[model samples]
Target: MSIFVRLLEAIGIASASAPPIASRPAPVGPIMAYNALDLSDPGLLEMMRDGRIGVSGLSVNERQALRNSTFFRAMNLIAGSIGKLPIHLMRRNGKLTEKASEHPLFNVLHRKPNDYQTASRFKSYMQLAALLDGSAYALKIKSRGAVRQLIPLARRSVKPQLSDDFVLTFRYTRPNGTVVTLQADDVFHFSTPLSLDGLNGVSLLDVAADTLGLTIKAQQAAARLLTKGTMARGALQTEATLGEEAIAHLKQSLAEGYAGANAEHDWLILEEGLKANAFGYNAKDSQLIELMKREAEEVSRFTGAPRPLLMFDETSWGSGVRELGLFLVTYCLMDWFVIWEEAIWMWLLTPEEQKTFYAKFNEGALLRGSLKDQADFFKAALGPNGAWLEPNEVRESFDRNPIEGGEGLPRSGTTAAAIAQADKPDDKEGSENGA
Candidate 1:
């Protein structure tokens, strides 16, 4: 621990030893409940507007509004590469015979699913990201150029930053070889960046968040490689804490909201379990990511697209549900901070720089935040008796909460919770499904 602390001190990062303490105290993610804040808060509304979040690249407020919007949910469904409707659903003589039924408990969940194909999911997501008016945008993104300069810098081996946002940043280590440290500026697009050199700053928080995200993505890929064909083991474990934190945060919001029910003081920042910012990764996200990567690779093999993934920006799709007197907006940054790191690393990032970027950019934030919405959907479906729900009843209550605002996700919170508890401090899950 002392040697690790010293290395981080070399990178001009001093708060190295204390980040863990700060993370533990963070409030959990909020729950969806009807309140006026849904309509009043510009950030929440912005998330409702666009279907995707640009993270640092776009306006945070607008992204917030876009998250609560129903339009994005409709779009996300149709963005699949092949087609929207399941192949089985589109059989030769299959007709739209049966009208989709609405759930009695929640009126919103009964709505018909939408499927609009997007031109380029990522770039279209970039359009949504354009909403961020401040810095975090850039041009002439020649990854090759950044790698050329940064890779050599890694070999020199200066003092490590020791921040939680490190690869070696987050329970990482120096492989027994020449070290190469590379920082990603792509996620750090600050419009009209200070020097006009397109260079913005890297906060310890941002770096930490990025590391978590990268860890999830890379670890997911690794898991896919490690497990032949089995349910994702790693994801289940990490989700335990992730779910607990989320529930705790939401419950706090409920208390605040209930306490001030008659007053205008409607919202407060829910404590986040994720320690880092945008690229933050918790143990649970990594576990699931391990499973997701294999799912992604399987898609690659099946589609022959080299690598293909059915991406869902659940966190950005929409906000909390609002009804007659109740207006709920679960303000969770549960959206994927960065998806497809392997593709990003292989195609966008250089070979040499892949190590650092993979561990850094994505790890800055947690991969899974959409769990809040799933929980919300369950609460909504459970009527006013969410607390009394039984195990199967819980499953039944969630006839299926679509991802964020889309299709049915993993079916039950149990599955999601199990995965969240799986991520380790080092983000290294045991090889349970060692095929």
Candidate 2:
């Protein structure tokens, strides 16, 4: 079997038997049609041939890319951010909105998505898969016309097919090597915004292969350097021309006596008036730190994560933590939120429910600041002057239970009873005020 086929099998994707290229049908719809000759499809051919190998000669598939620290950190930042936030199924009643707790999807999205995974964990896994593979798929197991459980599928295991009439089908390979074709409504697909054919999302790993490859190479170089005790290659100079035997003996001596970490500090013992002349650049000369920083920035740019969040000491868009966090939410996570919300509406909500019910990630928690700042914000929200939020609303934000009579917005200072008696309006003024 080919390495590509092995890789596919390793990831639970079963490769189909190939027919002759001449007998294959023409490309149709937005999906890339594959002929018996995989080489006919440029994208698939590239993946099979190059396996996303970079200029640095490093393979940069999703798993390989995640091995880089910067890439892993960025993925974790995005996935964790989406995971920790609460998602709600909200219902709209004219101008008012409230959580649709009675909806079947409410518990599946907010509390537990499946018997084994909590909502947070499922979201994190899905987000991570989407970020890595450019698309994430989950089976929407329904009961009584309502989705009851969501089972995530391996990205490689599911193949999407679009018919000429715009019907979508998913061919999924189970762990037991069984292939089952499912309709559009049976699957929940979330893809990144960048797409050429609309039906499938492009993988970020493939797009940023060169950058990530260089990063992995740089990391390997650093590891090798550390293993060699930060040593640089040098030449042993001698006035006398060395014979082949002498050179071999000298090379062996260097390798056995002074090559690795244990012999790093050992003094070189040279004979016959030989001198050590350093030639190649050391880690400092090569600017490894600067290279790593550039790679980190590249990862941040590609993953839409702030550099500061990746543990870079430099200041990002804002100086304060709250501003930086806001930057992350607004720039990095908002698109993902929209993707999830729209996907939910598309796959989970019925046509009648779509008009009134929608999904939303409550990002208010991520935007919150320190305790003092939160207190001031709640106070202002519940203040008497044009009070917009009830006391119970503020308490709910803090995860506190509502007290009796805390549901109403208190217009204390603005009330007629609180107004000064001297400032009280006369009969005509009072009538106008009441009007």
Candidate 3:
């Protein structure tokens, strides 16, 4: 253990063990249900475990609903895109030299963090937070005097409580139920602030709560329709009086024979004068499908994720997909990238180091256009009026090695002639004067 940890332990500020069952008392005040100030609230952990959402009208848990819905998959795609990209530190002069680029800071970032998580895992964790919870948090683990590792904190594991002095402190609960009190500086927080509590972020669930609730209700209704037989709606009519056993047998047989997708085309026979009379067959089916479509589209619209991404809008295809993809990167993903970049710079780097170095996400990886688009872009970039990037830079985009003599730009005739004339300045001036 580090001296810092030992010092904290000595001062009785270290993480305390989980209290005994009898020792834990009932909470009080407005935060009575789950004490926001306390890290290891059993109620909080139980809510997380059950995936319970207090938001009314939702039949399902927020986390489960997000996973089951297309929005979660779209979020995964966005998160994965960012997580796979190279995020590195650049020097003040904008060069990525060995000293600046391959610093220990970057090594900790790109390699295993605290000997447990991979670089990709770390980035993905933050990405998930930015998308779903509107915040990402990390515990800054230090070795000696310098910051060494960053451990990503689960969104459900930590709660940020604001004191009367307007100071922020984190109440983090470990997996073993140990609650640790950490100062704001000890935790790295990246938040998309929508309220006064800048430490905690607004959940996407909270924003799309009503819509999600409606979605769940719609899904439940559809499941009921399917389980009760999609085509076999309405009631069974009979002229002859039936006994309780006969009615029970008939109900069971109908349910087993025609109830789910697997029993769709099965023969549903009603003996003993019991006739099956179906109602709302066509209208209900169409309405159910339409309701689902509308709900999915609503989710897409509210979340800023494209409807086409969730396969709800077939109209947006080909070039429209590309346009939407670019739009998503610019509007949705770019904002998230900035949140992460700024947080990393502020939290990871010391005040002095922040001046010399800054962290940036490689947006080019996310925004790279089509082959034709890239060709045109590179052509314009290498043109006489453009600031020509080296051939190695272009080759790197194509995942190819640089060729010898490819560093120099292919000069235009006008540029070459201008250069030649400029070299012979005296001759050029004399010729102009004689003329």
Using lDDT, rank the candidates from best to worst.
Answer: 2, 3, 1
Candidate 1 Cα deviation (angstroms), residue 134? 28
TM-score, candidate 3, is: 0.70
Segments of candidate 3 deviating more than 4 angstroms: 1-56, 94-99, 144-146, 164-166, 230-280, 283-286, 318-321, 408-410, 413-435
Selected candidate, larger lDDT, 2 vs 3: 2
Q: Tens-digit lDDT track for model 3 on 1-435?
A: 566455345434453464543475754544321233344656434454454343544434456566546677667767786788767766676453323645667776666666788888888878778656667788898776456888888777877888899888988878765678889889888776464555667777657766677777777777876677556356878899999998888878767777889986776676777676778655455587788778787777766665666666565565744576687787667777787778878888888888887777776865666777776666556555554665567887889998875676656555533444445557579988999
Writing each residue's lDDT as its tens digit, candidate 2 over 1-435 gives 677566555444334575533476864553222212244556555556545877888767777877878888988888998999999999999999999999989999999899999998999999988877778999999998899999999766787898899889998867665668989898999898888888778777877888998888888878888897547577778999888998899889988998789997799999878999987777788788789889878877888888777887776446567787798899999999999999999899889899999999989878897787786666566654566787778788878999887767776653321332224346348768789
State the local distance difference test value for candidate 1: 0.31
**Candidate 2 lDDT for residue 124:** 95
Whole-model lDDT for model 2 versus the true structure? 0.80
Q: How many Å off is the CA of 320 in candidate 2?
A: 1.8
User: Which one wins on TM-score?
Assistant: 2
Clashes of each: 97, 0, 0
| Per-model TM values vs. the true structure | 0.15, 0.75, 0.70
